[model samples]
Target: MTALSEYERLEAEGIWRPDPEAQRQEVILSLGDATLVIADDRSATALAHWSLPAMIRLNPGARPAIYAPSAEPGEELEIADETMIAAIEKVHAMIEARRPHPGRLRGALIGGGVLLLGAVVLFWLPGALVDHAARIAPQAKRVEIGRKLLTEFTKMTGQPCHSPAGDKALAALAERLPGQQVIEVLPEALDGARLLPGGLAIVGRNTIAGPDTPEVVAGFLIAAQRGAAGERPLHRMLDWLGPAAALRLLTTGDLPDDGIAEYAQELVQHPPERPNNDTLLHAFREAGVSSTPYAYALDPTGESVLGLIEADPFKGQPAPHPVLEDAQWVALQDICSAH
Candidate 1:
């Protein structure tokens, strides 16, 4: 407030326009403590007081400088007095020097660095921790957790289809598919095949009752493998289940029942991502299973899965072996129907 002592009694004549459409009138402009006062010179009545900090000059380094209360709106003062203009500029410079300017190059860099650190803490750290947890988990532990998930899934979907003939047939089907160590057919609440922490893959009874060939079922298992994307199913599960779940499993050597149940419920609610054409074709080739039946099962007309059908690994030839033997296919189809 006491900075501009030299301009204590500074007064100037200025043309004031209250608005754009109003008539301009000569007014007395005086600087007060932290304010610029505009008064009717003849009537000696104050017209307006603009806070010095808020006042903005419309034209800098121009004669008869124009100013307004703010960068917004139209009330303006046109002043010709050089002394008043110079004093205003000096006060503005002092104010600018004291204000925090984060937009400055050095400040911007510091602010950006802070934001980057915050992003790593909020997003990247949790993901990295989950990956570490998954990487360190032994295959034995993964199989243990996977069977536990199967037990939980059964609670929501009922017991998986099983019979003397069906179990043997399903075991044969799993053997035929390869890479499918644990395969079960759920009665309900399973949208698609969900590969669990170990090499377990669960499918719906509808797919069995629906598709003519077991190759469609094998396709579902291959698609579930794509969900891992070269990562283990445990990693995929922990990623979706979040950092808390990963930490729990890592520290306690088991996930909380609530978290496991929630994951089981969520699994039925969401379908696993489909395997892309290239991935499915590669998997089919590796397993010696034809991809055409599976491609058609995905899209009856094969319109959307044209790539899968055309790129079938066994396009010109039959599968190296049947996906299921004639009797096995019939027995597998009757697996869920038995009980």
Candidate 2:
């Protein structure tokens, strides 16, 4: 009963010492059932039975390794055999695996409870339950989902533009923005801005770089914050994917590629409709941003978006602060080129 069947015949030579005062002697070394057997080389008489699990190498990673039966004061052996040292380490690892895992049983019970609860909820109200799951999903989970969606969207959108300096600059802007959104720039794949789950927004490269001022881009972002009377993108995604996708996300913390593929395609193909003017103005006012720049950006003449131009929120007085510094805007605009 050796540590392993393959190592049953493994043997090596080593020098052994019976105790601190005993003279060193050459010995025959061999592996036994969970033990290291030391024998008198001349007589072949077993002299020691060192428990493999209790063995400790005093000099690790050096030639002629020194080993003691345990940490306590005891006899020691010096073996330059790499094979035996590896086998001993493997036996220790096996013993470690057999040790009790703290809280494993408790964790399993909690996970089972969660799965059972999710199942019961799905059985009752499929649609409503899915909506609730998406709405209440933790921010970290939503961020995970949103990042995955962006990766998938790249199949059609190509890669989103990113560079070290640009990403740092964009992150700074995101911190100051209303939703603290992760905004990505996609070249030509999108003509307008669209929101994803979590606080992620994707806008066309042209939309971000072409605008004369960051306020125009900021308007597009604030409008995407609340779509068509406050129905967020999370709800829209669940509705499109149906209850099955939502339930899967809640239970498994992920969605299959097939489940989200079609929606990702649809999202890239059809950009979100323009946010209502009243809602847009309200968002602008709340975000401490101007709407006229956005209106003029939308219609250079400001004829079609005259209502937004007239009802501009930051019109009467100066803004508390600009949307972004001149340098930050330049860095963000340079993302596509740098990438």
Query: Highest TM-score: which candidate?
Result: 1
With a 3 Å backbone cut-off (N, CA, C), the pairs that clash in candidate 1 are none
Residue lDDT tens for model 1, 1-339: 323977548888999999988999999988878998999999969999889999998988898899999987879999999888888899999999999876796888999999999999899989988998899998888888888889999988889998778788888878887677878999987766888877788998877879888887877877777655656688878988899988888898887777777887778888766756787789889988888887888789989999989988899899888888878888888888855
> Model 1 TM-score?
0.64
lDDT of each: 0.84, 0.82
- Itemize residue pairs with steric clashes in candidate 2: none
**Candidate 1: lDDT over CA atoms?**
0.84
- How would you encode candidate 2's per-residue C-alpha lDDT over 1-339 as one tens digit per residue? 577777648788999999999999999988988789999999989999999988988987787789999998869999988898888878888988998876897899899999998888777677786778777889898887788888888888789899887787778767767676788888767766788888898877867778877887777777777675677777788878888888888788777777677888888887667778888888888888889988888889989999998998778776788888888888888889954
Clashes of 1: 0
